[model samples]
Target: MNRCLSTLAKLDEEGYSAPALARLADRRAFPPRLEFTRADIMEIRTRTAAHMSISGVQEKISLRLHRGKLQPVTEDGEYILKPIPGLALPRFQEDVPANENLTMQLAEQIYGIHTAPNACIRLANSELAYITRRFDRRRDGTRVAQEDFCQLMGKTPESAGPLYKYGASYEELGQALRKYCSAYPVELEKLFRQIVFNYAVANGDAHLKNFSLQQTATFGDYVLTPAYDLLCTKLHLPEESRLAIDLFAEDEEPESIATYGFVTGADLLDLASRFGLIEQRARTILNDICDHRDKARDLIARSFLSDEAKVVYQAIFDERLRALEIRG
Candidate 1:
């Protein structure tokens, strides 16, 4: 019997399980095979690029789950579909979708980070694509007011230059959250845990545009939106920067990050201090994050990454864990 790629459950001839299908939509059958080809997706991407608010090198098309089947749409999309990109020349491009799917699942299932609902689905060519239901959209198709850190900081390519999004520190994001979010202490801890999780998984692309705040039911209140774009970028872009942004701003680095030249548990404790957390609370978070090695490895084993990719992925994971240098 084969394993269901979507849920990683034992399959009884049906490729997806009831729970996995339900995750896509209540009582939904396996999404009907996409009517368009990858080439069709490229053409649509070209025509729709100006209209889409989401940004990245990978090609993505807005989709809506209509009447139990997924269909591509140019407007008011309830889900976002990302096929293996044709650009940027990343290594092991075929594994990119599964890499993202596995990383997102690890964040949500293992570390308990709130992530956008996501899964791996088959493209028309039998290739895999990453799909996530849009958290900013409601069942009735209204848009939620959400703003990424870049926007919150009033940054743009023109204002801050080409690498604008990468120019800041995670500490700046924490400060921004403090000013905007009414529930600062609680959300700050969530942000700290997310940063630790990103390091653990080697998601080096967690930039300003990747984190956001969404308006809540209280009219003016805001909170961190569910995590999106979570992935092990090191697997694809091995030679790229270790992190999209510095863990701390200049003049704020602890001796550990300054001397050792990478993040250590000490540096994280310093960051938590900068975020106004007490030392003991920070250590507890770090210890808790460090204790999840076996669970992460088990999920990696069950993921859909190719055998070669899986080995590289685990190697990256182990190396990042060592770099963290968690203490007693």
Candidate 2:
């Protein structure tokens, strides 16, 4: 199928977007014949699902909105919708959608980072689904050239070895922006804030592919894609390190490393300083993140996560925020 027109979605009252807010309010009322039950989604996975071509083993379906109704399609789509994965642990599975939805919302609304516009909607069976707009595709049906850090760094199993995406430090990404971005000084700060946000929220999965450079027709130069795929992985993987990958390129000084792959605010400041950012600017960003706890907690409570999961999410966030602030 040919996706000939770009989808136009409306910004929600809360700064997120979904098919319902744009023109499909009927989805909520009508029970979405176009939507699926979890079992139906699993069956579709066996049918040309690979043709949809996005990565991550999570159960996602490409969707096209025709005349205010959404239908699953392998091509010419505007949104990527995810149902709760059957593989997630039974105890924590219900929180996954809200965990992700709230984190992406928190990134944009509180931290001022641009993120893929998203919201939680329901399937016909009333199962929760997370839907996010496709930022890399234009309304005219042309794909914007976007490259993840893995591709930009020329990484592969042969070149960088297996698990290459997680093998490098985020500091390498900073080094890359310096080399490729025409406006590094400005974009550099955005990247810095994102890293800080990821740490504060306890996301242990911000690997190379989650960060990307996208070309915009207006600017004619590459800048960061709206951040997506953010969540508190710590809730599920309680044993996981505070970060998925290292934040620094060189070895940390003797005092820099903290517990559990954690780093200090000073460590983050040092990271910024190494990248030509001054100590004061680094401190400003780090402190701003730490100081936003009340707002962060508010968002958590308002999220779709179960009450217990919200408490756990907040606790993980508090633990990490304190870790960063304690070093100040």
Best by TM-score: 1
Question: How far off is residue 80 in model 1, in Å?
Answer: 0.8
The TM-score of predicted model 1 comes to: 0.93
Count of clashing residue pairs in every prediction:
0, 1
TM-score, cand. 2 vs. native: 0.88
**The candidate that achieves the highest lDDT relative to the unseen native structure:** 1
For model 2, which pairs clash? 6-139
**lDDT (10s digit) by residue, model 1, range 18-118:** 76666666556657356677788888888888888767777899988877678777788878888888876568788888899899888887788988878
Per residue, candidate 2 scores C-alpha lDDT tens digits across 26-58 of 233322334567788778766858688877878
